[model samples]
Target chain A: MSDLLEARSVSRSFGGLHVTRDVNFKLTTGDRVALIGPNGAGKTTLVNLITGDIAPSEGQFFMGGDEITGLSIPDRVRRGLVRTFQTTRLFANLTVADNIALAIMQRKRITRRFFSSSTELPEVRAEWSEILSHLGLDRLAYRKVVELAYGQQRLIELAIGLALHPKVLLLDEPAAGVPHDEAPRILEAINRLPSDIAVLMIEHDMDLVFKFAKRVLVLAAGRLIFEGSPDQVTADHEVRRAYLGSYADARRPT
Target chain B: MSDIAVTHVPHKRNIPFAQEAAGALVILALGAIGWFLYPDDLAFLTRLIGIAFLVLSLDLVTGYCGVATLGHAAQFGVGAYAAGIACIRGVSDPVALLAVGLCAGTVMGLISGALITRFRGLPQLVLSIAVGQLIAGLANKLSWLTGGSDGLSGIEPGKVFGVFGFDMYSRTAFVFSLGVLVITFVVLQRFVRSPFGLMCRGIKDDDLRAKMIGVSIYPRLVVMYGVAGAVAGIGGALTAISTGVVGLDSVSFERSAEVLVMLVLGGAGHLWGALAGTVIFMIFEHIVAAANPFHWMTLVGLLLILIVVFAPRGLIEPVVLLWAKFKRKGSAV
Candidate 1:
């Protein structure tokens, strides 16, 4: 099977420090990959490179065999590759439902007519209601996004990503600021999503990285160190020594 | 179990009809009153409406869509020149002149919009001002076509629909100008409620996120700016019809700035705010100018300063606040 996303000899640097250096990575279609790394390991930068937010200093990125390294972020999204931010980006003044509806409308043919009604389309309305209902956001549909709790805002972000209808969803620390109690629900939402859309998730939580991802890739100091199952990763000696040593005892639930 | 069930059904969307009819009635009443009274200064009032329509166009782009434009007067001038040049060449039909003006305005707007939207922030404003100056320069250089600062003259009001001959009287002009204003206002209202307008709002709020969600900002702004130009072009042609002349002042920076002030003074985001601001600013200008020439500009400057400092939402918001307070007081009593 071929990888749905591929990076070849990707390296990016700022000033003297080498943030990412000659990293090669791949994710097969429908692959659930967990990227685990210590702080400042260039995990987020890798995601940015893949999504075309920043060009690699040296290397190429291909999505479904198409060179996407030079494409604009919006054009990359239209080609079915998208990335979410570490912090949520929702239109604070718009309603939760409107935020989703606006995303869906972006995919349609936009004309220059002064009086044509784009919102009156039945399909657009149905998709809006469907996304809202599927995400359990029906009750907060009309409420302003700023009024929602932090967790709810994160869900809105996920809903926004869902509306893009991307084939690959890149989540950058989605559960970072979410509460302990609500984190599982969000994780469960990701777990329950359809298997067609490949997910590349960057997380610090060992349990979350273990619970949801089928394949694990570890990064340390902007380099890919290991790739295997969670059990194989937990049992590796060097992998345990370099990063997982601190979490060794904490890996098992009390 | 003692209560009987009842059903409620909508009686045919009365709000849209009522709003439309009320707007039409107001315009008609104003026309009838102007015709009967035949105020000696009715021409001035008709000219005010024409200028107000131009300001409304500026308000839609700058206020509603968050497009920072400093050169829309170029569009107004293009329409005026197109219509004037057409008339001077014996193409005296009003409908033909209107179509010509609209086409000229649309082309100018699209070209300028494409150029300006490529650059962002202060660069956008600077580029627009440069485009404005470019048009103004062309108008000055094209001496034969534009009359070269001597000003275009010998314009006759001709006839409406080639049937009712327009006379020196302001009655026909007033009615025609009022009809155009009502139509423009209704179309703008519907536009702001549509999905395209909503996406523009989203773009204004956050361009990056809008892009992430697949909203292309540049092309959208270009289209909207073009539409706004078409509307303002009509306004310029209307001004030509009423005044029977086109002057360099139609493309002045001061004219553009004054319209911006009217928009900010009326309120942003609300279409009626633009209309209300135009009306108030025109009335204010008329009263103050009548008192003294310098007093008109100075008074507008002072009023704008006060509004910016005290009530930045414009006069409409303050009026709404006061009305709400009065209602609450009456209910308490």
Candidate 2:
């Protein structure tokens, strides 16, 4: 099958320090891949490169075989490449529903409207309801994003990403800063997402990586060390030594 | 798909109809009261209406969009000058003059917005102030065309549609300005409640998130800035037409600062706040100046300090809070 996204030997450097080095990546439809590494493994940088948040110092990016290396971040989003931020970037003052509704309106190409309220539309309302319900955020729909707990805000971030109907989603630590009890709900939300969409999630939680991602890509020192099934990833000596650490043996299934 | 529960979710829509109607009613009531209270001061009332337009326009960019600008009066001056020049060259129709002001304001908005939006926070404020000062300086320097420091005089807008002549009593000017104010307020009311307006609010609240949601922030702000300029321009044009004079003060930094004060005093994001702020500030200024012209500035300063300390959001917040409380009480019953 043709890859939905491809990064050909992408390398990004910040003047004397290379954050991403000659990293090649590919994602296809229905692929649930986990990207795990140490603190500076350039996982977020790779996602940024692909999402057009920052340009690659060298190498090219493509979406469905179309060269998108020159596209701006919004243009990339328009082409169905969406992402969630590590820091939970949300419209703090707007209600959770309004936050989701914004994405729906933008997708509908009706945000430029000057006379009508886009939220009053039945289709937009239905879309927000579905997305919010899937993330189990329906109860907090009317509340402002800032007022919600960090865990709820993270879910709202995912909801916003989903609202765009992305073909490929780049989630930068979806469960980071979320309480342990709430992390499973975030995982469940990801599991409930439509299988047609490809997902590349950057996470540090081994339990989540093992339980959620079918496939796994491990990064070490800005380079891909291993790409395999989650089971094989845990077994790989280099990955275990470089990233999994002592948790590799402890996390192994009998 | 089966897991998706299709509940009958009642969306929270901005009820602009009632809000806008109330706002319009208040403005009209003010006009009526002013007409009756000071029948001989129609000229002052007309000037108040004109300044209200400027404040409303400022609210769109500064309040809603969070664009830190102090040179908004540049567009006002542009409109005033455009209307003044049109009258001098014999385009004396009120509607035609308004159209000229709108066009000039829009162009100026586009140019200044393009320049100012390139920076953020403090730089934006400095650039805006600089632009306003530049326009004011130019008006002063171009004395032959603009009448310079002496101010552009001899502008006589013939009549309202060639029917109602401008009388010495200033009644025509007052009625014309009231009509303009009502029309502009209604249009702006609809605009601020629209999806485009929501997008602006989004950008204002969190611009980075706005970009992440595929909103092209710079261009959207520029468009908003242009719209604001056109509105401010209309105000300036009204002043030129009603007073038959356009001065460099129209583009002065002090004028920009005064309008900013009016908007903040009323409340920034709310459209009604513009009218409320302008009316309160102007009336207080007028009353105090009459009482003690020299020390009026002192009272205004004290009032601003009190407002900032007590009602940081502006004077409208208390009314909004009370209205909300009243609604809650009624609903509870």
Which candidate tops TM-score?
A: 2
Model 1 regions lying over 4 Å from their true place: A110-116, A234-245, A252-254, B1-40, B316-333
DockQ of each: 0.32, 0.66
In Å, residue A46's CA in model 2 sits off its true spot by 2.1
Per-model TM-score versus the true fold: 0.88, 0.95
Tens digits of per-residue lDDT, candidate 2, A52-135, equal 888999999999999999998888888899999999999887788888989999888888988775566668888898787767
Candidate 1 on B126-196: residue-level lDDT in tens?
A: 98889988888888878899986866777665688878665676767877788877887777767775778
Give Cα distance to truth, residue B99, candidate 1, Å.
1.2
**Which tens-of-lDDT digit does each residue in A149-244 have in candidate 1?**
998888888888888887888988888899999998789778876788789899988889988899888888888888899878887777787688
Clashes of each: 0, 0
**Candidate RMSDs in order:** 4.6, 2.6
